[model samples]
Target chain A: MGLKRNVGLMEALRYQGKGPMLTYILHRIGGLSIVIFVGLHILAGYLANHAWGANLGIFINSIYENWLFQVFIFFFALFHAINGLRIVILDLWPKLIEYQREAIWLEWFVFLPIYGIALFVIVRSGLGG
Target chain B: MKTKQRPAPLGGFNFDYIMWLFTRLSALAMYLIVIVALTGALLMSARQNMSIADLMRWAFMPNPNHVASTNIPDIEVWKTIFWQVMAILMLFFAGAHGLHGLLNVVEDYISSRRIRMSLRALVLVIWVAISLIGITVIVTS
Candidate 1:
């Protein structure tokens, strides 16, 4: 508590802005989504491995060979991507001492374009008609 | 009595407790997935022979018939278990980079919205890529 009194206006604002708070929340969401994704990943790979005496691997390789699934893959991937970048940005910046809260909000702004480009490229390739 | 040693940077009892809890929860979910799948395979083991289509259909669309006439419970188990193990493994890659960044942020010495956004975006890419590959593997398989 004693250390807090010396905090400047910006420091105080940043603290109130909840960088740590948001991180904690995002961490949980990211963690859960990852788990869902992981579960699916293993099942797919196991099947693809042609395990249980089948060549399911071949089917998986060509999954994006269709349109709908390719799009499904795109959005799931995009959500995870945008959220992930936010977590990273929150951590790497050394200026959390002052503009940290501002930075947290800024994450949303930066995320949009990146998400769009990534989605476009992935969709085009995955759905390459 | 011996003096208490200094706590490790993040090694308090509370931290250890949480880690244990997380491991146990994750482990339990995984164990159940495997057990169910195996039991289903057991019923199918009798008239033994499988193919890629057999595996694909089994994984994506769970049913007693898909498992080669296995019991419904077994196929049901396989339904959720399918693809999870692979995703967990993929997580190892991101875990190395993402978790480290998370901790670094926690211990940040500076705070800037622009910088936060930048790093967040980077990790977002990682998250997206990993998941994309994961989905591609699961639904397609």
Candidate 2:
């Protein structure tokens, strides 16, 4: 059997799988975000230390250091970590598959407070508070 | 008495299986490293001496150079081979796990076997370059 390749963007948008669908999309986005962030972070570190690339390194660091960027990175990192953990748990114990939705709710329950505190700190520091 | 039956192996030791396992193990490993680094930082008076940025850098990478610009008077403690190894481990695990995840996502959108192979090769090259550069920086600094 061949893979179905006919799903259009509009069709995708119109489909509503609700919470699972939302989490699925967000997880992918979160994963991609972390990959980009980590890549740039390592590159920046290398550049900052190298004589020829020091300025560029500093430039990249400065960009990510902006509170706005920090907020976005933190959000994705925390979400990815939490969501990944949930997936891992489900994989380890297939019996828990029945509670998948509850697991996601619990994920958010755990995610929000930690993220909230981090967000507050970031915003406060950003505002020079 | 009923005899216990051994389950057959599912597709023994393929690349996808290994990577699937690697993804999970690496996530756990990174968490462990980060926690250990965070604890070490707190012990080193991170809250009192380091800014949020410095603390974060140390937590994520734990390389001595990451804390070089911080207010900590003595960086000598951080300049050990142990932290160097920690940084290298972080670099490799994160690089492999993340790049593999990206490749998986890309592969989902690409149907052609040739295109998939090319993309895998590209991701491999990028991962190697990132790992090498990261290791060099961690070691030399």
Candidate 3:
């Protein structure tokens, strides 16, 4: 918290760069991905008896085991948690809009790592030994 | 830089500017961590003799470095990290939207004070239970 962020033109541009717009943009999209995928996920959970307990269940099973699936879940996890926190912050501190920069730093520094560690643990164990 | 429309300043920094910075920084971080992790995974497996699906079995495993049973620490650490993260995300996503939606439903129809409290409690209980199950699934392997 006290490393001194003497942001130069390049470094400043790096922090205030073009990349995060996509991040925020995609974070919302990731929310949509989970919502869409999870719908099938829930349906599969319920339809476990149908398709000889196949079809949707199989799709769901095949997915979490997949590496891509893990990564997909990770991003969704990152954005969803971070964005959720954003909503929480909005509710709690509607007047602090001016400190959005600091808030974002806190979010990324705090939230994303929380997400990565959380998801890494969840996927690893839940998927199995 | 003053204008007639300029409003009160809370702390020298403008809220809009801060949000912009947040979106930028968060986005960059997301790209490096999530996006790069994903691409790295795909590229690493591309050279494997087996198909992509076969390779995933190990990478997503607790220890990507190990071919056999990953160490207990791998399972313990990674799973703990993974589930806790998922739970947070799920809570935010499911809790925020679902609970909010449920609240709206109650507000619109179930306008009784006692009944509303009861309904809200029920929703909280359900979400909590689900979250617990999710935790169990993540933890127990």
Alpha-carbon TM-score of each model against the true structure: 0.34, 0.91, 0.39
Please write out the lDDT profile of model 1 over residues A12-59, one tens digit for every residue.
556754655765555555555544444444455555545662456546
- Relative to the true interface, what fraction of contacts does candidate 2 keep? 0.35
- Runs off by more than 4 Å, candidate 1: A1-30, A51-98, A125-129, B1-141
Model 3 chain B weakest 10-residue run by lDDT: B1-10
True contacts kept of each: 0.02, 0.35, 0.00
Which lDDT tens digits does candidate 2 get at residues B101-138? 99989777765667879998999999999999889888
Docking class of 2: acceptable
What candidate 3 gets wrong by more than 4 Å, as runs, is: A1-20, A51-53, A115-129, B1-141
Maximum-lDDT candidate: 2
lDDT of 1 at B122: 65
Give a tens-digit lDDT track for model 1, residues B1-141. Answer: 122222234545785455434443433343344345444444554225554335433433233334544433334444454445533443444443444344345334234446656776765665666556545554443
The lDDT per prediction is: 0.47, 0.86, 0.50
Model 2 chain B: weakest 10-residue lDDT segment is B1-10
Per-model tally of clashing residue pairs? 43, 0, 22
Ranking by DockQ: 2, 3, 1
Provide the fnat value for model 3, as a fraction from 0 to 1: 0.00
